[model samples]
Target: MNTKRLGTFVAAILVLDAMAHLYWLVRPASDPRALSMAVLNMDVPFTPRVLLPLILLLTTAAIAIVAVSRGRGGWPAKAVVFALGAGLLVRGALGLVWSSGLGTDTGTPFYRLNLLLYTPVCLIAAGSVGLVLARTRRTGARV
Candidate 1:
């Protein structure tokens, strides 16, 4: 894929990640359900200290992947994208598993949302990055 298309896809992935983080951050921390879930050790709540820095790291990585992938030599760019992509995929899968077995009850809605729905979104973003990397490699772009 060309730089423009690659950039667009990566940008979209970043936007999706931001939106998910926003939802998690804005949700009421002290909600009775959340606390109830916490009692069961199922729903660990989000703190700004954790979420904000995570967001920053992910954002920086996204930008770096775009820049390095587009700049001179290709391997470095591909490596960055692959590393981040695979990491996200693993994180998302683990998050899903955590969501499934967590909280007061097996049927908690948060579990369904986080594990079932959102996990795949992260995986798809990771897969997109992988696809772009494969394309770059096929084109024989040197790192």
Candidate 2:
């Protein structure tokens, strides 16, 4: 598969997500339903609310650089992709515990929205990146 395309896809999603987070961070009231995409129904410190998405944005940027660069190889690429996948997995899917019929909802739309929508996207992006990285390693292509 084309790792560059996958990287682009991941970058696009992460950029959008980062923008959304940044918006919410700067204007915390703009988020409809008043629930966080990263944190569930609980109150979060300003640090995570601002930094998580910013850090994720940087991670995606790095992934895009590695994927698009011709020098893509070695542990650097692997480490970046690994970190991206792990971060997305944690931020996206894990929130299902509070939203997915676990019966602990704070009754915010974000829970359902996250569980049904963005989290899946995150998982897909992460999986695609991992698949591309693995393919690159297997075929010895400069993914």
Candidate 3:
């Protein structure tokens, strides 16, 4: 798809993600991490439990606009796109590390959720930003 639509898709995903986190923020008792902690001994803090998702929503909203604006004409657009891609990629890649290779068991549903759900979403987001970044490179080609 074109840059605007791709950005829209990413924004929609971010909105959905934020909504999920919103559910947790509203009903902390029902937060999924509670199960992860109870079953797998992982502890997520308030930063990630609430703030990060809100930040992600805001950032994605900004980046979505940037990604569709003017086809990467300036440093601001490039920076936003790069930051967005990097954040998503790190979320997916680092999540793999975070959930694996400790005394931690990889077979639990917590890890499974990251594997099956979170990581894929992140990678897809990164790919969307990456596409926008790719167009920036091509359009920036010197004569």
Candidate 4:
């Protein structure tokens, strides 16, 4: 895809992630334990203290993506986008490994969801961002 389209795709993914965190923050699951296990593969509380920072981070990522895509922000914006892509790539790779029962239990809901949803989304978003970076480099555009 073109750089613009790729950036838009990545930004959408980030926005959706932010929305999901917002949902968790506003309407916590009936069973926080189950929800946490299913989502994070851990027992950590899904409180606003946790979700709020995630929401902010995801929102910032989306904004940075939009700015970079529009060629509005300079290298600093591009750097943020690059960092976001790298972080997603690492998370996806780790998810793939963990979901395969290497680091996490295969029977857990998180394993299934990570394998089916989270991992793929992260990988796709990372790839889209990578494509945008490449296109910008090739075209000599200030993305």
List TM-scores for all candidates, in order.
Answer: 0.63, 0.70, 0.68, 0.94
Candidate 4: pairs in clash: none
Off by over 4 Å in 4: none
Q: Between the candidate structures 1 and 3, which one is better when assessed by TM-score?
A: 3
| Segments of candidate 2 deviating more than 4 angstroms | 25-33, 37-39, 45-49, 52-74, 91-99
Q: What value does the lDDT take at residue 132 in candidate 3? A: 67
Which of 1 and 2 is ahead in TM-score?
Answer: 2
Per-residue error (Å), model 4, residue 53: 1.2
Per-residue error at 52 for model 1, in Å? 2.4
The digit string of per-residue lDDT tens for model 3 on 1-143 reads 77667767777776675665565566555565675474335775544545565757555655544555346435655666677789889988866775675544676666777767777888988898788667656766311
Q: What TM-score does candidate 2 reach?
A: 0.70
Tell me the whole-model lDDT of each prediction, alpha carbons only: 0.63, 0.63, 0.65, 0.86
Cα lDDT tens digits, model 2, 4-61, are 6777777777667677667666665544344543345555554565567675766565
Candidate 3 CA-lDDT value: 0.65
Q: Judged by lDDT, which candidate is best?
A: 4
Q: Residue 55 error for model 2, in Å?
A: 4.6
Q: Which pairs clash inside model 1? A: 42-103, 74-142, 75-143
Model 4 per-residue lDDT tens digits across residues 1-143? 66677778888888998998899899988999999888888899988999999999888888888777766578888888999999999999998898768988888889999999999999999888888777777887865
Backbone-clash count (model 1): 3
Global CA lDDT of candidate 2, please? 0.63
User: CA shift at 131, candidate 4, in angstroms?
Assistant: 0.7
